[model samples]
Target: MATIAHHPATGAEPAALRLGAGLMALAGVAFIGYAVIFFVRNFTGGFLELGIGPNEVDVGRAQVLAFSPELFRYMSHLHIALSGFIASTGLATAALAWFGVRHGLWWAYVTAIVVPVLALIIALPAHYPYHLATVGHLGLIYVATGIFVAGALVALKPMLQARHT
Candidate 1:
């Protein structure tokens, strides 16, 4: 495995870099935790999101259970798949942030940013058209994204400086 190397100009990593990477990692962990919730809800029938209840979700668990077993199974499958993807993304982001960005690797920084941003870009728009963009469904993600952005911004100066020197 590749190891993090300190920049020649900078003998030790800067505090800013560490803080930024830590924030990014925290965001990544949040994603993982959310994924876990999604996964557990699949089995436990806690289909309600944070601020959303069965009524707001447009379909109650009881209704789905009564209407079609197939539909319920399909929904469960979707939840499993979504959870897997989210967890994987979180794992990647955390690894990159803690291992690469913490070490001041520019490529790692870029990739860490790209991975989650790409996911949000692909996933977020669909929510709006369906009016599913409510805070209950997306608030946690928004907070995580904010932390990721803050981390990126915080590390930017130091990363650039390390690169130039």
Candidate 2:
């Protein structure tokens, strides 16, 4: 029987999950970076700048949008929510891929698959109004998400086999 062995989890097999972790980390960093830049340019003088509107809500988000006035609030919610989930997925995926492969944790693999799928599902609402506009965004969301999830699943191979001979 074939068996897989690790370096006693001495942080040696980090490469085991490197592919998945690396993808996740990269995606997460991108999300965080975009959020920072977006948050900055929203109120300040940048591409995300929005015209001051005589609008007030009890609990309103501070994000800016280039959509219709009626859609502004909803779009803000979508952007923030999508950004949050993407960033979260990225970070968790990195951790999952790294530790899961290193320590042979199936939960990490499962998480890798789950996080993106959930994020994509959450973004489904964006397609209702105008699918054309959201096409690119949705594509990006799923591409990045799918890659990591699929990568993690692929990386599970080495961990699933028995090691005892």
Candidate 3:
């Protein structure tokens, strides 16, 4: 007779990890969506119309000239890179958290908590120039990201406690 051995890490996943996985997945999707929007707005002829509009202070202020090949190229690359980073991070966090590894748990927790903070800081500087558009965009993106992060953090609490003990 053969018996199956139980493995703690590979057992039925914990509820926290499950929830964290879902949230991270959602965040990843959101980041991808944002990235696509950014790409459409900047790279193609879509231009400021889709975003803050050409006449917006950020555009008119001459911070970065619209239609400048260099500027658009830079923005395009930046948005694409950000999208890739966020989506990959979210997916990785979800998978690792699901596996219940200590390092994965910690990574999920850190990514959840840190990304939004950094994003908020970056968004703040744009507020003076972009005003409502900047605030609204930043609020929407970071808030959603924060929610996912909060969920990850909550799920990781047990792991966190284990470390302290």
Evaluated with lDDT, which candidate comes out highest? 1
lDDT of 3 by residue, 42-74 (tens): 555554423365445346213455457587667
Pairwise TM-score winner, candidates 1 and 3 = 1
Q: Could you tell me the lDDT of residue 149 within candidate 3?
A: 69
* Global lDDT of each candidate: 0.85, 0.52, 0.55
For candidate 2, which ten residues in a row score worst on lDDT? 49-58
Give the per-residue lDDT digits (tens) of candidate 2, residues 50-71: 2212232222233334335556
Which pairs of residues clash in candidate 2, taking residues 3 or more apart in a chain or in different chains? none
When 2 and 3 are scored with lDDT, the better candidate is 3
In Å, residue 90's CA in model 2 sits off its true spot by: 2.7
- The alpha-carbon lDDT assigned to residue 123 of candidate 2 equals 54
Assess candidate 2 and give its lDDT. 0.52
Report the poorest 10 consecutive residues by lDDT, candidate 1: 1-10
Q: Global CA lDDT of candidate 3, please?
A: 0.55
RMSD after Cα superposition, model 3: 6.4
Q: Is candidate 1 or candidate 3 better by lDDT?
A: 1
